[model samples]
Target chain A: MDEMSAESRYADWIAVHAGQSDLRAWALAADGSVRAELTLPSDSAMPEAPAFEAKLLDTIAPWLGQGSTSVLACGLTGLADLPEAITPVPAKPAERLPIRVSANDPRLDLLALPGLSQANPPDLLLGEETEVAGFLAGNPGFDGVLCLVGPRTVWVQISAEEIVSFQTAMTGEFFDLLAGHSTISAAVASTGMDAEAFVDAVSDTLSRPERLSQRLAALRGQHVLQQLDPSVARSRLFGALIGAELAAMRPYWLGQQVALAGPSDMVDLYARALDTQGVSAPRHASDGLALAGLARAWFAMQEHAK
Target chain B: MDEMSAESRYADWIAVHAGQSDLRAWALAADGSVRAELTLPSDSAMPEAPAFEAKLLDTIAPWLGQGSTSVLACGLTGLADLPEAITPVPAKPAERLPIRVSANDPRLDLLALPGLSQANPPDLLLGEETEVAGFLAGNPGFDGVLCLVGPRTVWVQISAEEIVSFQTAMTGEFFDLLAGHSTISAAVASTGMDAEAFVDAVSDTLSRPERLSQRLAALRGQHVLQQLDPSVARSRLFGALIGAELAAMRPYWLGQQVALAGPSDMVDLYARALDTQGVSAPRHASDGLALAGLARAWFAMQEHAK
Candidate 1:
């Protein structure tokens, strides 16, 4: 199917499900024009396997009733329980296998669509590059990637070609830990970070990274001696450590773009850091990325079948 | 004087001080017998200098106002702010200073006792042979000694002696760091510990105490692999390490007694641990230990002057 027909078909399926009491829909508009729309069940509580399957059928039957709506997609394994009328899209190898709703009947169309799968993958896939590569190698029918970064950063890189992955320590998380709980943490308390002081400390340490351990020790000593507040020292230590990590990781993504993900405030801070280093900002979106990526992956799979 | 005369004298003093709006009276009773009393101008907050003299004055002032109430007969800090009126009651070198107060400082009288120099003493006097020796050595007194036994197990020891001292560590705190925020912390989420698990771990490792490092490594591995709950492992690690410290310190106390002081709940727990190990429970009280010790010291100074 051409792009226009494919778009029209997806729209009709959404429209048929729009009035269903059990479904919730969200539409995104660009320049006053509806760009895309997605729906989920309003009362989609899955009970037992059979009940879950019934709900899945109830959710999708209307969409399937629109004969033109040929493809039904879900990122959860629960959707795999749908009647054969709903074609369950196979997850790309890079994507996570939907959690089995029941062990006895594994053939149920309960599998989640590519959108949800790509949006949030399994915890095991987080921060593991080798596993990401393995996932991609196994599932070549995925397109697009969604990366979650912050306290526990996760990358869900996807393409119809498969998933590629790498995981890194949450330097931000480390910074928080040191600030809040460590003996070194006490030094920074009561003293808010002086941005200039932090930048100076970071710059100094980045130039001579081996001093990080010694600096931490000294800061801890000063705190115990009551010479410094723990919080201030904590902020400085965090800034220095994260700065070092960033400096180290800079070479890895030299040319490749990285999309900013996670809480907006954190993303803003990261964006500022990236801007300072003269790196280009990567494209970013919340839910849209997963939806568009899933659509693209589904379209590619259809073309391959044709 | 008989009890009636003593009561009459106290009443007169109280009447006199009652007219002084700024003065506050605090009565001391031992085993339901009126032992001593003190009255002070609440406006004259505890001063920071001439530490011993100020404490002595605060201790005996009320008794002196009652017309030479015999300190030798009572053997207590006779009233507040008149230590010179009391005769010193010499004590055995190892005997803790004698003073008594209620469990919590619920009464304003108990709190109004001039600052009992207590808390951390100067480092030089730590591990001194006796409280008397500590006093003679010019060791600053302590108000209280808070002994943390494990992550959640704490024992507060108050010094009924002229000088007080205590120790601290990062065992429980470090466990929190490792289990809550560290890379390895994630491994132990959702694990539970049997009450005996830690005790068993400690006992087993006692023969080869150096095995602690190895056990820690194993626990860390299990946790990081998500085979154990981080909290359980963290608590276990804390209990094991603290248990080891207790085991080491138990021998040093030998036949000597120890008073567990702090919040009643903490003292009870420590007492239970000691009981399980067949250690004898000594007298435990909270507020007046330091004050009593200071009072005894003041009496000693008065006798020396005489």
Candidate 2:
């Protein structure tokens, strides 16, 4: 980082969020204040030891020194080595003991953070736990359901600082696959989203969720029969999927204090979808929550050592 | 074909069924008995005139004579040039006028036949119309619904040999895309069908058509948490999708004489899914119906000439 020298102990520590798409690392000083941030394309969803170590070094090596600098990396980066990365729920999000990486570098102390898992509905999360912890850090006494919208949208129930249960929907994956590569890609590829169209489609699908496949085919039919606006078509596709999800997940967000977290853009989309249902979703920056969660974990580990 | 020599009027005419994946054509005698059958990969869903003409000639040229041998073609082969191919419903499936293909070969008389369309529900079918015609040709007095399964599965409401209305579902497309490339592909890539798992999943989703997305996600969760058999996982995934479709199309199959048409394997899958709902779906050889419908169109065209 430009803020400090690279000779020795340049960064006191580092916190990283390695996800399916990319890896984000923040170099932190002793006070847990971030000095600089670096991002790189991820190695894989669940990266192996050698490749994960190489990526971590490439991300943090310039900031490393001859002395030990602890690296607290969360997400799928080192998950394969961390057999305990899936912590059973009804406990703190940061309850699992992060596995130490089998490393060749002397100045490295790497810990792979584990995500939370629920047994009832059979659900698991990769990196959202850190963000949840970060949300909890900001709102210590807050108790409500958190909707984290990302590549995989997760509906989490929280009370007394423990993750009670969660439900995940493959809505994002379906959206990506169908919109990018499927036959509906022509209708889904648009530079803009139509708000009115999105609302209408959401209502339609919410009222009749079972007709989702038929509605998907209708997108193509309407595109062919009528000159359906690309923006409107895209919005309608998203709306149908989100609407159906909301109907299925009514028990999760029907009458609860709800907050939305993720990248602001996607978070806003979910916010708008929930708005149609007359549910107000407060927004939280996913990256900020992630950093906060990582810091909280680091702070707690420090406390445990003390 | 080897059954007939390449000479003048060795075969009276040809009936073709061109679809999204492939094209099937039959050289027939004047009485409509199939002299020989041929199948080739389709040019495209809606191919250009040049490619369609080339493929048609390539398929039928060997059997053509010095005389203008009439070729009656149907499906997506020549659909692009036939804007009027979408024959409006409340009419016979073979009611649309066939468009003549502009050709350089003097001995080939190729005509592109169109399929039936419905406006209310916004549906389209490329080649399924011929199969419906064949079904009607055999059962002129029958009145009920037809489920045509393929790249896109269509449910047609037939009344007294005339098309009433139809619904198109992207179940096949969705199933193909998800099982091939999605994150849960590992769970879906199986070689066998688990009947019990499929039936159970069908009932589960039939009772809860709204929870389709969650059930999809649970496939992955269960695969990871438990020793989920690949075949069972694949069956569960299919059952969920088809179950949801059946729940939506309950009105189409409930208390109706339903016939399933398509490739035998896919038709059997739909047949099984419908059987769970206490509906008996008679299987129809899709190719036979397509050829029969084409021959019927040829016969009617000749009668018009007379």
Candidate 3:
């Protein structure tokens, strides 16, 4: 089974999200179990169309079998108005479709899926849409806000399997800048998450959003004034940024059914933040969602194939 | 004169704000005219007492005469509760004194000024305090909000010649990061300012402060969606950040007599922001304000000398 023999190609589907710096793919066995996963840095070259396709194939070559299998992909950035793709928001979930991209790999029938986009506010999500779709597929009739805390956090309003509206915050990028790229890096520890400090900081900023900048400086101030613990500093910074985000995103999570889908620790933070608002959210692990979303897309394409 | 002469050193006072990256000083003649100005990078070495003084004298060597002079200085970071420094807040302006630093450079009698500190908020202003003092000295009996828009913007409320309260915003550093250092940098022109777009952006963020992060991402979205002009992108980003800042700082400028002190262009932007709120702010050129502030301290020191 470990060998890449012809019989090994029994996997039914694969899903790939070609991000700017990294490429991640999931392979689903015939029984819909995630059979294999692959991750590789995509920074070897810019994603010129053919090169990107070839790179995707090279990264997942081990999982490929001589048997033709359907593959679905989504890039890190969204593509709009693709003829084959579904307009998730403007249409009913049951009638929606995923964008289909032509991939010229011999062993795979590859179709690239479209990410979500909003026309009026001009919002876009490339890869996370599939994850959301997968989450919806698993939890049918899930209606409420889904918060995905990733490199960019997206808060989407989902009702009856449809994405109503969504907003993205630069939470992760902001965190990266504060912890490693900005002036405050010297004063904060990039590691460790202090639950208590994170909660308090979140609460502090939520009440006084006007003091966001001052409080940011106070991270350094406390570092100087009281020898602030590095873990505490990290927590404070996270809390402040997230607090500001929550303030902006209050309408989405306030007194609503909230579900969080992202990495475990990030989901934990978001869960805790919402908890303070007297809102309880169910936490879901986001592993298999991408493949599930791709499987959905593949199933849709089969309808097209017929 | 091309030559450094003894008579040239006859200036009665020197004022310096030793910053993290640069040192700026002003030489005050006996009659209070700015005799000369000097600036140099402060990063040649750490600001140890001897080296800092030596570096200070060396940079202002051409302006120094043989005459004994009192030097007043402010470091870039606050030193709270220093015995040698006077606590100005809650003290009458007439009774305030500079924090005297013992300098090895015998060419001048140097007294380092103490920056302002806020205990409740854990805020500090190292160099801007002197500038505020200078602006107050120049515009005596003026009581309202004074905004010094520099590397760090400070809004101070003044009444009866005493510093009432102030708030600091990392506007400048935040702008630098967003335009030149962050992921959005590529989408924005790091140089030009688009006045119209700026004003519009400021208004947008002001109304929806919670959408700041979402709007930041929208800068990039606009780039892809509409091919947003780099200059316009820059303007919009600036406007959004400042707008969010203004939203937080509404109490300072709303229906208050506002005064701005900083570089001309920065003051212009800030003035325009206040103007939108029906607050007309007189812009004061920040040049020589530090020296004037140090001069104020020098006069106070003379009273102590008596």
Q: Report the number of the highest-TM-score candidate.
A: 2
Candidate with best DockQ: 2
lDDT (C-alpha) at residue B228 in model 1? 59
lDDT of 3 by residue, B1-306 (tens): 445356655566777777544788777777667767778765411245666666677776666566556777775522322322424344344345776556556667767777666655655556667777788788988889889886567788887877777777767767776676554676795578889999998888888776787788776556655667898998888788788778878888888888998889888988887777777899999876777777777787777789
Docking class of 3: acceptable
Better DockQ candidate (1, 2): 2
For model 1 the local lDDT of residue A4 reads 39
lDDT of 3 at A168: 79
Clash count for candidate 2 is 0
lDDT of 2 by residue, B1-306 (tens): 554544433668888788767888787788888777789885334667677778788887776766788788877765432435566677787555566765667887878776666677766677777778878888787789999887778899889777888888777778887888776786677878889998888888988899998999887667766658989998898889889888878889989989888888778878988898899999987767877778778888877878
Best by lDDT: 2
- Model 2 lDDT per residue over A112-227, tens place: 67766677777777778777888888988678899988767889899988888889887777888778766567766796899999889889988998888888878766665665
Tens-place lDDT per residue, model 1, B31-79, is 2233445444422121222442245345545454423232211111223
Worst 10 residues of 3 chain B by lDDT: B77-86
For each candidate, what's the DockQ?
Answer: 0.06, 0.50, 0.31
**What TM-score does chain B of candidate 1 reach?**
0.40
Instruction: Please give, for every candidate in the order listed, the TM-score of chain B alone compared with the true chain B.
Output: 0.40, 0.91, 0.87
